[model samples]
Target: MHDTERMNSGEIRAGIGLALVFAFRMLGMFMVLPVLATYGMDLADATPALIGLAIGAYGLTQAVLQIPFGMLSDRIGRRPVIYAGLLVFAAGSALAAGADSIWGVIAGRVLQGAGAISAAVMALLSDLTREQHRTKAMAMIGMSIGLSFAVAMVVGPLLTRAFGLSGLFWVTAGMALLGIVLVVALVPKGTGALQHRESVVAGQAIRSTLRNGDLLRLDFGILALHAILMASFVALPLALVERGGLPREEHWWVYLTALLVGFFGMVPFIIYAEKKRRMKRVLGAAVAVLLFCELFFWQFGNSLTMLVIGAVIFFTAFNLLEASLPSLVSKVAPAGGKGTAMGVYATTQFLGAALGGILGGWLYQQGGLGGVFVGCALLCALWLVIAVTMREPPYVTSLRLPLSPTALRDAGLIQRLLAAPGVADAMVVAEEAALYIKVDTQKLDRTSLERLIESAPAMC
Candidate 1:
């Protein structure tokens, strides 16, 4: 077979296509976060607590459905389910955009959140990319989301002026439509799509994800990350309008600056950590930064500069945690359950978000900044503890090997390949093959993989 046929994937290109779809949907969530509460107060029947509920309601639905939807994608089809979810989300956005009362907005927000597709996206990327490249593909989607969240914070207000609230929904609808086009035009077909079976546990993929301890740690990290995020937004907008002296129309600038500076600030350290194999240390430092920001918000958020300083630190750590957690999850998750693991992880994240908003509103109502900060600090502290204990996963690589029935009979080859140096684990699955090659990053020998494959092509 030719090199192209042997590859069985064009991971980098296909990964980009998948990342675009994810970025669009994240923009949908991020748009309202930085300004929603302050402006939302004008709607008839609005209340402080009611506004907080609205801020978090979307996550409630997303938390509930993320895993189920992902499992569904394994059965029905990724693109079709995603399309349906988008339609529901767009309809909900339109409903909120046109609402005359606070209740209407809440209802619409619920519908909009039902479009949650993060889990399905992860699963689909796993199906499409080779094992060695799967983590990279997942990283692409994660980075897209981080960049989108940062960009949207800065752009939402500017966009609001052009379209108004009604425009936000309409634009959301239009974005969904565009996403549908990408799904149709770009997403590569998956081999698993043809025989993706339905069962109580959805087979090995989900079973493995459920049993992983490392993945659980990462999951806890994400839960804390988003819980604090949604809770902060519940109060930040009001803080800005009241204490910062910023008009609602210009609030995006705060987000724009914080997101940009924080996003850029994180790059050097992230690269250093990843290259030097010091991920655990970097991650610990990031969590510490997040906790410090929470304390800063609690103590000195009496002025715009203080809020902005707090926001810069908050989002810098947020971006890192958002992207790194998934990559870390991939390292620990069971083979083929990339989707299910992410689904569970995302559900936890959304649940945290919903709880954050609900709890933040209640806390603010009763005890103000001290209550919220104490709660967020507890979350960060929990993650920091987990991060410190996390095992530094060796560089694990995945590969795809095409197989037919005839190849299954080549008995000893699979076992022999697994015994090779640097090969920690191997799964010579039918139709697809996976290997978790533990590598010394500084001295990886590509030739071993090639030589091993050449010696036992049929078994591989």
Candidate 2:
């Protein structure tokens, strides 16, 4: 493997551009969550079920379209898919802005979700970055998402108050347009054909991803996490207003406080997990914290202090779990199956969000806020049990090897590569002309590996 350098100016520019693009689009989506439950009630023919559906409709389309959009990007190119997705997203925002009915809003949200460009965007990022710096680039995107969500939680209500819900949707549309401009004007163009195996999906990898028990547990964990998040919002806004005596516009203050505190609180634990090699322990504790927060909300939701405390705990645990899950997935996935593993993880996440909305709305309609809390708590409990089986994520990194077709087919060569010290796993895909390897950096025998590769018949 070549020793990749630190990110250069162009790489930094591309990473920031892509991060902002992702952040802006996510802001458009998340800006509705904090106040939508109460505000959306004004829509014609709105009911709990329909409102929940409207909130979650995007996930349904997003979940269904993610992989296909990713695969399409591989064939046609990333920028085109991204542009089309933003346009669709903008169209959805426009439709929602014009809608007077909840069903219309739902339709628009679904279209917004149908603009599934996350995979394409990530693939594009992978295309432009070096392997060593790829994680940092991806982390920038992740941080953008976290920051966007936090900012949206605070900004969404203020926007709603000033311009009304329709106006907010218009702003979302504008954000999507801005995202398009960024993609065209700022994001760098990659040379040559799309060639990132680490971030591209393969059909053959799916069965193996499914069969990996540890990876399955992590997927289920994300599903439960997002489900609880969507469901909580379905009731949280109402609880803040009716029980806590906070008005709609003031909701941002609470969210701002909780998010700030939770984000900071989560950082130390994440650092501890990484430094101490206790990722599984930290992850399990975070799930347990989530369960406790749900139960606490159920019992003491009416009190302002409890609401604030629960929000703090919920977001803290949420941030911790959210950050850890992806890292765990990367480690647990088979060497060549990161993309397939992530695709499945993402699908489960969206499905969970959709289910949460429906379940929360149904519970609220049937038995109010308390019922919603109880239902979510039960779900978390189930997740905790499953989470217990999740093994510690391997401390490893992925390396891509350029292997010639002939060398790839050489059984002895493949065996020798696998037997190399520090190589945890290796997968050679002849069609892609690459060998994917998982290596523990501290233990990798670079000299020996280099000698073997140099002695090989041809360069890929």
Error of 1 at 132 (Å): 7.2
User: lDDT of model 2 at residue 389?
Assistant: 79
Instruction: For residues 40-70, write the lDDT of model 1, one tens digit per residue.
Output: 7778998767777877888999988877787
lDDT of 2 by residue, 79-192 (tens): 999999999999999999999999889999999999999999999998888766787898899999999999999999999999999999999999999999998888888884
Best by lDDT: 2
lDDT of 1 at 217: 81
The TM-score obtained by model 1 is 0.87
